[model samples]
Target chain A: MNLARTTSTTKGKECEAVPSDGKPGAVGVDPEQLWLRPTEPRRGRRPSFSREAITAAAVTLADAEGLEVVTMRRVAAEVGAGVMSLYSYAPDKETLLELMVDHVSGELTVTDPPSGDWRADLKTVAHLQRAHMLRHPWLPAALTTRRVPGPNTLAFLEHVLAVLRPTGLDGAAKLEVFAQLTAFVAGHVGHEIAQAAVSRSPDRAAAEGRYLAAVAADGSHPELAEALSAPGRPLTPEATFTRFLNRLIDGLDTD
Target chain B: MNLARTTSTTKGKECEAVPSDGKPGAVGVDPEQLWLRPTEPRRGRRPSFSREAITAAAVTLADAEGLEVVTMRRVAAEVGAGVMSLYSYAPDKETLLELMVDHVSGELTVTDPPSGDWRADLKTVAHLQRAHMLRHPWLPAALTTRRVPGPNTLAFLEHVLAVLRPTGLDGAAKLEVFAQLTAFVAGHVGHEIAQAAVSRSPDRAAAEGRYLAAVAADGSHPELAEALSAPGRPLTPEATFTRFLNRLIDGLDTD
Candidate 1:
């Protein structure tokens, strides 16, 4: 497949505007080229590798290592392809990330139809998302940026819209609900993951505890000091997520 | 400042465990060394620059550019210091990021005490954070990772903890609420910024519209089609934020 042919329409001027460094304002993947275009090069001799194979390789690398390590060079090495050849499929890391995000989103398979209870169904959707983000720890950060919904993402979104059907929300409102719910979950899960990491490192956790203790004792933060002194029962990450999720979802008003 | 002397205690085996690529689960900045330790290197002759100057330089670079551009080398150049000398202040980009987050947080000065209404006060806090994040677009992403609180952050946190004092919640729960609120604001601002970027690029926006239209036209996505067709009044990002923030905050139960 001709790489230039695939992305040339949206690649030239617009690409310059889009920082390829994976920041929030970067132009998203061109949906038509990425999701609608043919996976194989139309006019060229068949390449040995598939786009699916490359995306999978990148996802595996991200899952095992981190997003930073899944660079074009590293992903190509993982898939036994030349770095130049990888660009034919994914022009840059940004495009690759879009593919990776949509690829993992395929796992969000919902067989059950909306149970007619919008609040309950929405909560279920959030739980599914929370679990999914935990599985792909990089997702919360990746999602902070805009991603044009690929086929898999669109399919999952369809389910969410259907679940929200009972809310009688207009198209935009329903969409906003989904986006807000997603951002909320992403925020919660990111914090949860970071907190879990702190827990995993005893020394780091201890250092933090001591530091906070010192801060609490500083007299200037009397409230903090009191809060620390009268600590309450600890909640698991899941419990905390559920508590916050219920608040956000249940507070949603159809009117 | 002697970088080795400051960091040696936490830098050896533990540093290996932490991925320095700015992912969650990377050991956070040590609060004692980073915040409590004197800014000046105690043993060595005074360096040409102070840690405050280096942090300010990096913040300026990040404000104009993005976080990805704020490398140790770039920040050093910005401050007119050698990269090696820059290490004395911030050993790595991660540490610099922690500094930047705390530095900008100083802008979040709440002169008026909490208005006794915990919910109203919390809403004010969220609004303040939203404004703060908008000023420094890099903040939303930076906060995704754990940052040990420096003096400025602690001061802001002290104010927030005081606001939550009226909630009658214990210390741990109060702390969790602040963390959750901060995360929520970061997530919302990130989405808002990405959406704004898309709107700024007419070509990208048109392409996206065309792509979504094609998807909506496809018979499989009937709900999406209906929603897009009946798109109601579009809420401004601020309106949307306030709506969701109200839902999250109003639904918080003291129990």
Candidate 2:
């Protein structure tokens, strides 16, 4: 039913579209149809399940498995619906992903207002985001694209904007800061999670160590060899995140 | 063949594996076999094509179309080989991806040595990476995983290590800096490319503007409303990148 036209009709929404993986022709979800419209089917008889149920199911699958396994058929099976029927709720996997992302963003509930120390407040914001992404590991990748902010995401964005109010940066600058901060956190957490997985597998970690040792011994990479030889105190992922976050946030110029 | 055993046997190589997509069980390519092993098939009569050709073809495909369209079968067809035969070179799409990422990295040729100003040098290193990722839009997603550094990637890494030598950061810190910088650039480019795509489509841009306007009008998103209303001097992607890069690099503490 002219899906392309329907999806292409909306743009410049809050969350950026999913990373296109360099696919230039990719179209993001229409915010109007996706967010503004009714959650249930308008014309058909009331179904036993709701869109929220479907989205929750998809999020569960992604959390347990990975984004790779959250297929339409798999998600349908989880919700006890036919694949075709699931189409009525989320036209495709992309739409389902949009739904899944927003569904999980519901957890980013910040009750306290900004503390007025913008940098300190922003650090807390990033920490909140990092923890949230780690809980729902699929989030960082899901966030790489343009996403229309669903109700939950909007609420979080509103809070972040309020936090930035003390900075006196223009509205656009505040928005840019939020987007960049989110991207930075996502990138850091994505790496941190992958590193954690490697650390979990002792065999893999040892193998990697040996592999690097061999490379260092090759003489061509003297700097690497020296770096490896005098390895300093190993920092935890949380420390690294804070270190980088401080650098990024502190470096932001209000002028 | 025991594929799992073969892949899990090697780790701690230079390039981190592809982003595990939060998949804990994901194993990276075996660096020894992938990088040190001969390019030609060891046993059988050497096939008509080389590993380099297969990787190049895959890269071309990914460049023209997104990473999603690059399948083993498609690559085989492009190289005029059977899909089964291609497996001898790259056992799976993951391995092929490892190959392709390193292959494109060959383009990141840095002729000058570190300029003594480690921050400036690191900034240059990041800018080079930003441009490289932009050229291969799929790189950001691919770099999300742990990858073994093949010869090309190793060559580039060696250059970066030299640049970091001035910082007096321990070898581990140097390595961490490089990884973080790469992730930051990938994250930025991924978002930049997606935003560019939206900008290219006027219809989509307008729809997004309308969607956000509606949200801003909803009273609940006052901060979003103000931010949208006064989006300051629209910054170019390059300027935004440079701004963020400065903050990140300048704020990096050598102590």
Candidate 3:
């Protein structure tokens, strides 16, 4: 009946609220009985700053500029709040980084895991993930899956498990399958973007032809050697990517 | 009778050499000449920088400091040379980058392609490549097939091709297989080293625990969730790496 009163510390200060073995306010504080002045039923919230809003703005800034320019003060300014106020939502800059990753994780759209053909389901998931990377190229560098998977990341994991459940593999086998597939997609996707970045680079283009010419003059790398000497057909990144992804998936399906 | 006396242009400079051609310096410059050295080879070169010395110093700099810090000035200082004088050996910074990567390539120890199971041979190449990455962590970021393969890299590729020749995959298929294996290994290795770097960050030790605790809160995703929480059964990088590699290789045996 008097749990709050009985739990007062020896210093006569209100200690951390503890459960009084099912007494009122014991474990769960009831919302209906929150006491307040008649004119205003409850306390007004702090300035409207949710983790979601902060993350969205951070993503925008990162996309517009780059990840290197993402600072706490800049994020706070983007969110229309003082830097100190923003710290209340995210404890530190690192915490903000984690939340930003979680935000991108929320963007992955999952499909109903397929039942009849596991290969199709895996491909669908792979393609969807590729699309996600294209949408937020910065996410991969920001969101790291270390010892734990965040909520949205777990949802992706859940989708993978659901799709793999129909396959004959057990838990360990399924886990291995997911790991390889994710690594394949992430690795390949990273390469694609990096190559794209370099393909546009003037330095890369200027150096590429000259180096090939110099080496092709006398060097011997057989295929490359011959190709360099000849008026060669360079493989398009898209063609290379298509061939690689299909073959890897095909190889995966057989085993 | 003087087929050797012809005018050619290369690098925006007209040259008087042998058979004139449209290509740069294509005055049929002596087929045997590696560098465009001064005619009477500059002797008494012992007191200053040499090409071998510059490349070796650059390789050491990349291995110790990251590639970004391996500036021309810094490298020249390391060799105790005037900055402009260093260029006499390296030609240019791009050439220096190429030489640095080529020097690292020289260390890749590979065997003749195996004659037995194709997948087995592929696995050997994969492991060897992984070892090279560990030996030179800055490599994946610096080197690519588009760049000249250098001598040892060419040998490694030849071994891979020889092994996969029996797999019945065409040129396109061979390229795909190689791309998948190498990109997967590079991305995975980069991710691993990145984790180590992040762990060493002053903030990670403090922030990492919070992120880990929140995500592994539930007994979630079963196997993945289990791996995250199992006491004294921490997933070591080597163990995880081997697991992924085995799965990928096992999946390839069907071909």
Residue-level lDDT of model 3, residues B9-124, one tens digit each, is 11212222323322211111222122333334435444355666777888887777666668889898898888877655544565567666666766665656476788778877
DockQ of 2: 0.43
lDDT of 1: 0.81
Ranking by TM-score: 1, 2, 3
TM-score for chain A as predicted in candidate 2 = 0.88
Standalone chain B TM-score for every prediction:
0.89, 0.88, 0.70
Winner on lDDT between 1 and 3 is 1
Worst 10 residues of 3 chain A by lDDT: A28-37
Model 3: lDDT of residue A87: 62
What's the C-alpha lDDT at position A234 in model 1?
A: 84
Q: State the DockQ, from 0 to 1, for candidate 3.
A: 0.09
lDDT of each: 0.81, 0.79, 0.55
Identify the leading candidate in terms of DockQ. Answer: 1
Would candidate 2 be rated incorrect, acceptable, medium or high by CAPRI criteria?
acceptable
lDDT for A249 in candidate 2 is 92
lDDT by residue for model 1 (B1-255), tens: 221223221223333434434543566667665665543335545457777788888899888877778888888888898887876666566787888888888899789988999999999999999999998998998888877887788889989998888788887888899999999999999989888988887878988898889888867788899899999999899999999999999999999
lDDT of 3 by residue, A1-255 (tens): 111111111111222232223211112111111111022213445346666688789988876666656888899899898987666555456546665665676777476646667777787777777777656665545432332344566667767867765665555456556665666676666556655654555444444455445544544445444433442345665555555555555555323
Residue B216 lDDT, candidate 3, scale 0-100: 46
Q: Which RMSD does model 1 reach against the true structure? A: 4.1
Model 2, B126-207: lDDT tens per residue? Answer: 9999988888888888877777677678778889989888788887788888878888888888888878878887767887
Evaluate residue B141 in candidate 3 and report its C-alpha lDDT on the 0 to 100 scale. Answer: 59
